[model samples]
Target chain A: MAERRRSEATRQAILDAALELAGEVGYAKLSVEGIAARAGAGKQTIYRWWPSKGAVLLDALLAYTTGPSGRIDDVELPDTGDLSADLKAVLRATVEELNDPRLSAPMRALSTEILADPVLAADYADRLETPVRELKLRRLRRAVDAGEVSADADLDVVVDLLWGPLRTRWLYREGPLTKRYTDRVVDTVLNGIRRW
Target chain B: MAERRRSEATRQAILDAALELAGEVGYAKLSVEGIAARAGAGKQTIYRWWPSKGAVLLDALLAYTTGPSGRIDDVELPDTGDLSADLKAVLRATVEELNDPRLSAPMRALSTEILADPVLAADYADRLETPVRELKLRRLRRAVDAGEVSADADLDVVVDLLWGPLRTRWLYREGPLTKRYTDRVVDTVLNGIRRW
Candidate 1:
């Protein structure tokens, strides 16, 4: 029992060190050696638990964004019976997360890395995108059941429309990602999806 | 006149060489020296025309995509009376451009570089994004004038919605960027924006 507790503590320390170092030097320059030194843990400890620096960074980002839950699967889309309000709430949270100074640099670094490297992109999609996509799909399904959405509406396309603009604005920095913008997006999409 | 023509020819050769090298070795590994060697031009010639390798790559990409016109400002959005059809046609063309083999690598490399480097990002926005965005906004304004779209609709949000899904799908590699998908996105947005 004591050994397990110590192991968990070491893991947390490694993740904390990764977040700190990533923020300080950016992810491209961050190394496992630096993380180990910062955490005061052995290099073997990091290697035994994670396959690469990318993996450690991924975990650290998830932990930082999602908190102690540390699992993206734990993120549930809000469904308050009002589909528009629910979507705006979720998107508002997303805008906040995207704009957070502490998280933006690492997220941008990870996004750039994934785009440049195909192997990492595939791994990231499987581990991170798949679950988050599934969760959003479930919420859309609930909207359909509640008769808020047309039965024939393509939920996949709808989901993409809802989330895509935010990603574009964030990645391209084309415009302000304000709540007014997000709310307008939700209103336009939800109005389109709802049965007249 | 003869000297001016020769200078123009040499500039075109440099851009072509930069494109070819960027495709062959990927953008991160591509160097100006390699480009100069491939083009049979002196490094000084390249530096005289463009300040950085990123500038060369950007010019090469724009030249390739925009064809003989060679100016992004020359590309205009279709303003056919049928907004939905016009939107779909433009998006389908965009899809083809995005999926082209010769263009994809350099484009991805440029995107990664822009996201990682703020100076490059600003330069890219100024050179590429500004003109394209302005063109799209013009089309939306025309739609408003024609009574095809609601006068009060947020044209900025609508433009983002129309273009964002395609970009997100392409950049994220989330799903197939099919013509069917593009048509659906246009239909949904047009429906939402149509004055009732």
Candidate 2:
């Protein structure tokens, strides 16, 4: 039990170091050697745990977002029972989070890392994205059961239609990330779901 | 006239060299010096012509997609008057383009480059994304005029609803980039536009 606890502390140190250096030098210049040095851990320690620097970066982001419990599935998507209001509130919060200056650099760096490596990207999707998406799907499914949304509506498509524009604007710099934008996305996609 | 012709040729050479080096070394290792060496132009010439390696990479992609005419606005979205069919066909073609193996490496590298630099991303939006979106918006407006789509639909939101999901799928590797996926996206967003 003590061994497991020590290992967990080391892992946290490595992830914290990875995030710090990735932000400082950006992902391209981020190195396993540098992360090891910063964490005061052996280089082989990181290699033993992660196949590449991008994988380490991914873990860092997952850890940061999930907090101490690392309970990623503990999503708190508001289900005020008014599906539209719930959606607007959640997406508005997302917009604010994305726009936060503190997160921007690390998020952009993480995106670059994800884009550069497919294996790491898959790990990201499985561990981080899938859990969050499932939680969201549950929320939408509840709405479907309530008859607020069409039974025939593809919940997957509905989720993407609402959130995908924000992804584009964030990654591609297509436009400003704003509450107004997310609100429009929610309303427009709700049109597809509620009626179609 | 002689100076202008030579300068244009030099610009093309630099861009060509940038693309080759970026493909070989990836954008992280791509450099003005390396591009200059390959193009047989001085580093000063490259620096004079482009702000950064990312800027040169952006230009190479634009030039490749736009052809030698450098006309970024020549979008050829099919308008067969069956708005749904037109959209499905075009989105299917897009899926094929994105799936092309020859384009994948460079496209990934370009995405990393864009994500790394905000100025470069803004340039990409102006030079590539905006023109294509305008062409798409025009097609949607045409449908609105034909009474096929609701006049009240925020066409920008409609456009994003269809295309943005694919962007998420592609960039995040969230799902298989398939004709089936694009078709579903097209139909789902069409439901919003046509009915709501």
How many clashing pairs per prediction, in order? 0, 0
Question: Please, what are the lDDT tens digits per residue for candidate 2 over residues A36-113?
Answer: 999999999999999988888878888888897778877567888888899999888878868874566667777766
In candidate 1, what fraction of native interface contacts survive?
A: 0.47
Whose TM-score is greatest here? 1
- Residue-level lDDT tens digits of model 2 in B1-196: 9999999999999988877787688777888889999999999998887888888888887888779877767656788988889999988987887787556556767786677677877888788888988989998888888878877788888888888898778867778899987887777776642221
| DockQ, model 2, C-alpha based | 0.38
Error of 1 at B28 (Å): 0.9
Candidate 2 CA-lDDT value: 0.81
Docking class of 1: acceptable
Best by lDDT: 1
For candidate 2, give the lDDT of residue B101.
51
lDDT of 1 by residue, B1-196 (tens): 9999999889899989988888789878999999999999999999999988988998888788778667877877898787778889999988887888677768877777777778888888887888778989888788777877777677778888889888888887888878998998888776642223
